[model samples]
Target: ASTPSCGDGQCTLDEDAAACADDCPERAGCTGAEWYARFDPITQEIADTREAIAVAWYATGGSFDAARTGRAGDDPARTSDNVWTAPSEPGVVTLWIVLRDDRGGVSWRTLAIEVG
Candidate 1:
């Protein structure tokens, strides 16, 4: 059988903002925020530090937060921007970025990043 595709102006259970970026794009002109990090020379991947795993929300009047939803237990450092940093340990980590506006409206974006 074939899987259903997104479009038609409806966000079904099968299609999410993350999966269907173009259809559910935000006013910021981006479906989601940007994840920034410096490259790791040793592992050839992103390093685990405050400087890495920082994200920038392109919208105004909102704040962002990050949390590690996987096995590791390291608190991520977050500002209104740079919401979370990847853990120093190596493995697959699920990261959540939550953005909220002054009027109590909220939006969420998640990424399963490899902290190798």
Candidate 2:
């Protein structure tokens, strides 16, 4: 039940909250690509808007549309509890919470949930 990793140069961490942000250079406005592994959205849909929810979107194991920002409610760290619904595609559609450590290495826990 782990999420995928986005690695460095492709993602960032939310200092205030316990979430990660994906690097999407093409995205406009405050919206950016992002993903999470541990946080589940389905279980959080009825919770308060302030709760953190895991989310991501991809196509064929590749980057699709980056996650939109401003969805994390009052959280100022740019983190969100939103669920990313990707377009229907072929191959493995991987989603994950890319984490970065002090060593500068990246790690991804597999969240291989197939997408159309």
Candidate 3:
């Protein structure tokens, strides 16, 4: 067996923190009191969700836009609410959240989610 490596551009369900940092980067501001996403059961089953999307956000970053891969549907909406949605599939979905500051400096974050 081989160890997982970050920045390989390939994010799999088996990948871990040391395996692929690019796909599983950490977000200090998007958890617990500052959660960014919520799964909607009404959308689809937990294992096979490639249609609907789960909402995501950036707790206190003003506001932002989003985009995703590995599914089918309209791209997640970009609004002040920062209501981005994850792909419905149950494994290894990539989500990119873009944040623009008032001065126009742009930055983003990515997550490799194993849905289920």
**Number of the predicted model whose TM-score against the real structure is largest:** 1
The best candidate by lDDT is 1
- In candidate 1, list every pair of residues with a backbone clash: none
The segments of candidate 2 whose C-alpha lies over 4 angstroms from its true place after superposition are 1-82, 101-105
Name the lDDT of candidate 3: 0.44
Please write out the lDDT profile of model 3 over residues 1-116, one tens digit for every residue. 34565567666556765657787666455221111343567875443222323333442222235432221223333333444444555444565555543223445666655556
Which portions of model 3 show Cα errors greater than 4 Å?
1-88
| lDDT over C-alpha atoms for residue 16 of model 2 | 13
Two-way lDDT contest, 1 vs 2, winner: 1
Give the TM-scores of the predictions, in the order they appear.
0.32, 0.26, 0.30
Would you list the clashing residue pairs of candidate 3? 4-19, 5-19, 6-20, 6-21, 36-57, 49-88, 49-89
Question: At residue 100, what lDDT does model 1 achieve?
Answer: 49
Model 2: weakest 10-residue lDDT segment is: 11-20
Per-residue C-alpha lDDT of model 1 across residues 1-116, encoded as one tens digit per residue: 22437776754444567877666665453333233465779889985342222333422222235332211113343333445445667766654555543223455666555555
Residue 45 accuracy (lDDT) in model 1: 94
- Candidate structures ordered by TM-score, highest first: 1, 3, 2
